[model samples]
Target: MSPFQPWAHGLNEIRFQGGAEGFSREALSELLENVPLAIAVTLGPQQIFAFANRLFRSAMGMADEDLIGRTVSDVMGDRYTPEIRALRQRVFETGEPQELKDASLMLTPGTTTYWDIKLLPVRGGEDQISGILALAANVTERVRARSEADLQAREAALHNERLALAVEATELGLWEWNARTGEIFWSERQKEIFGLPKNEPATYEFWLSAIHPEDRERVVGGVGALSDPRSGGGLHAEHRVVHRNGDVRWIVSRGRMLYEVVDGELRPSRLLGTIIDITDRRRDEEVRQLLVQELNHRVKNLFAMTSGMVALTARTAETPKQMAAALRGRIEALARAHELIRPAITGSEPSDGETSVAGIVEAILAPHVNQGSPSQMTFEGPSLRIGPKAATILTLVLHELATNASKYGALSVPDGHLRITWIKGAMLTLLWQEEKGPTISGPPKAEGFGSQLARRSVTDQLGGAIAYDWRPEGLQVRIDLPLSQLNA
Candidate 1:
């Protein structure tokens, strides 16, 4: 009762009776017509179609008259290439069956379809091959689906390759954990990050031990949060690690926990992420904080000193112009001292953050010293280290003396000259003498702000004493300070 039941009888068992009721040509044709495949028969050397089934006619988009007596080229047009002809000829001459998979055909002018084609040789009663039988199945959909999947797979591979290059360029360490297998994978860079041996396997216990003792507890808590659903399965932490050799490093880790559905329930399956070394950045941050604190303390001291200078200058100046000129000169001197100190405080100094007494004296007086004349100033001293605080106060005291000399003392005339000398022992002794300038009668009646500030700084701040002798030609000043105060 099946459409193909006639085929159940072997070819040798079939006896042609020349009637529709027996196994005859008409009966065979009827059986081929209802089969699912596209079946056709071609005859003789011209390969003219001798028979065509319903599916064959539909697949070719032709009627019986258009195909029955026509050669393959007449019906297929340009679509029947020499390759197809050679395949059919091979089947006819060798009397062997041939198969072609995923062959393309043009059933319509502009449309294409693919097929799996099988061709068989057919013989006449004379026992010689006379025709070809073609069986085909449409496979366009399957072939296109396979092609699309291949394209997507290639694109995904390219994407992963680019991502790996980016990670390597940035020196990022990659890691992965498989919860079900109790195994972990570490990239070569990841091993470098933890200072692990090349051949040593990465383990959870080793990871925990590598963390600094002070940070291990916090890191463990962060891991716990990674697995907790409430935390959205993500983690970010900055911590320290201690190597086997006792070298400590800072690191920042960022990762996420992956989940999979098992029996319709989501469960943690792996942890994956990257870690990068942050030791340099951490050190920079610490240095920046120290600089900020140092700058703040210095600013407060400067403001307090300015307030005192203003209050004291007001009492000594006979006019507002005098006060303004004195305040400006004092502040400018302070600014110049700040410039010398900043290089050390900001870590840009060529040597250690320490300055000697000779260095400070030269730096403060360099602007006032005339470049064209060598006789204007002279200095003699041994190198004595001055602390940062003492350097600030000493520079201010020397600047006040120089400002007075430039305005009214030895430095006011071209012929005037100044000499400085210092010696270091249990105490430091320094002398400032000026000569060949405007003659002075005696000491001033009232102590000016500059003189007051210099005296207070020497006696109160620097643990020293200052005395001035207003000689006829110019002035002389001598200062003595304990060695403890000079280098403190």
Candidate 2:
């Protein structure tokens, strides 16, 4: 055949292969060039860009002429790392099609792009490898969505961990039971709470065996009712349990039935719940109730004793003035003591039993201040709040000191200052220092109600010691009480 004939046959074959029916070589070239899809032609060994279509140039934001002669490295710069370059080289050497799905690429600063990259190996006449034909589809939005989903999953896991920690701190336990399989799963904390062996098999039998014998039947019945399909999945109960070591405990169990598909039909498959121990709380409530009963009984007894004292004082009073004064003083003292004993009867914690020291002082000093004489009284300390017994006894002692001060010492004069300063040490020390009053003498002529009550309160109720000194300055009384007693 002639050379012209061979060239004509070759052109015809190229036209047929290019899918350009009844078209010449020039027409086939024009059609291929104008096609919308991106296409590129590269040469062997160097993989230099030989040609590029309009779409390929537009996708990369470049002119076709600029991209045609430039290699991938020249056009993409450092965007193509050594690893990716090696992948392309492997594709060229193997002549195999390589596809990377959801691949990430950074095309601009602070902007990320994703792509599905396909590296198709092109072949020459003898089916020898020429170069790789790389095609990429932007998939940035889909990749971003997947990333957000993964972030949400991680946040959910962290939240769950925090919630579990909170539950553990509060001594709560959780469990789940598969109704279909009759299998129970207990959290490690739940096992510890129920006093079960860590290696114990989690099952209905194991759970029932651990329950207090008296509560086991009730717990089982409640759970059975909740798991029943006819009951519509409502079950909750609180009961008592006896642990392995014979310790009685209170447990509150709550769960609901969850349905799932098995084979074909829907059926109850699980009971998920939590258990909490309420033993200490229950005992505290019982104690509070008992204390309330005891308090009522004590109040009645106190009233009877006070009534008898008032009757006796009335009979002994020689005149109306003495009768009124005695009645008022005795009533006030009784009120002060009653206030001190209130907390002890109510079973409140020692800290909660604190009363205002200033109030106690005022109550005790009221009767003595009634003598129609100007007396200066001042209290100083590191703002102290003390328990019931301490307040009562301290008040009584201060009253006795004020009576003495008013009768003959500092409180008897308008200019006299009765400074009662209390310093808190390992024990509480109260100093009643009198200044500028009547001249000092010896001890009192006799022990009166104020003195006797003061001594009794200090020694008995407060479990403390008191000393009276006739100092040249004034009559100074020193009181020392243990912190525990004063606080309690």
Q: Give the candidate number with the greatest TM-score.
A: 1
In model 2, which runs have C-alpha deviations exceeding 4 angstroms? 1-41, 44-46, 50-70, 73-102, 106-113, 116-130, 133-149, 228-232, 260-267, 300-342, 347-488
TM-score of 1: 0.64
TM-score against native, each model: 0.64, 0.51
Q: Locate the minimum summed-lDDT window of 10 residues in model 1.
A: 1-10
Which ranges in model 1 have alpha carbons more than 4 Å from their true place? 1-27, 93-97, 123-128, 161-173, 187-192, 196-201, 243-247, 260-266, 301-333, 342-362, 367-372, 375-488
On lDDT, the leading prediction is 1
Native-referenced Cα lDDT, model 2:
0.71
Residue 360 displacement in candidate 2 (angstroms):
20
Error of 2 at 163 (Å): 2.2
Q: Per-residue CA lDDT of candidate 2, range 1-488, in tens?
A: 11111111211134334353566655655775776445666667787887666656665667877887678888878677776687788888886666666766667667777776666676666667776666566677778898999999999999999998998898778898888778888888788778887898676666777777777788788777764577888668788866778887887877789987767766788888888888888899887887677567557845764676567667767988877776676666666756665766565554434565655666666655536655477777876777655665676577557656775788777788887777888888888888888778777676655566678768887788888888777888888998888654
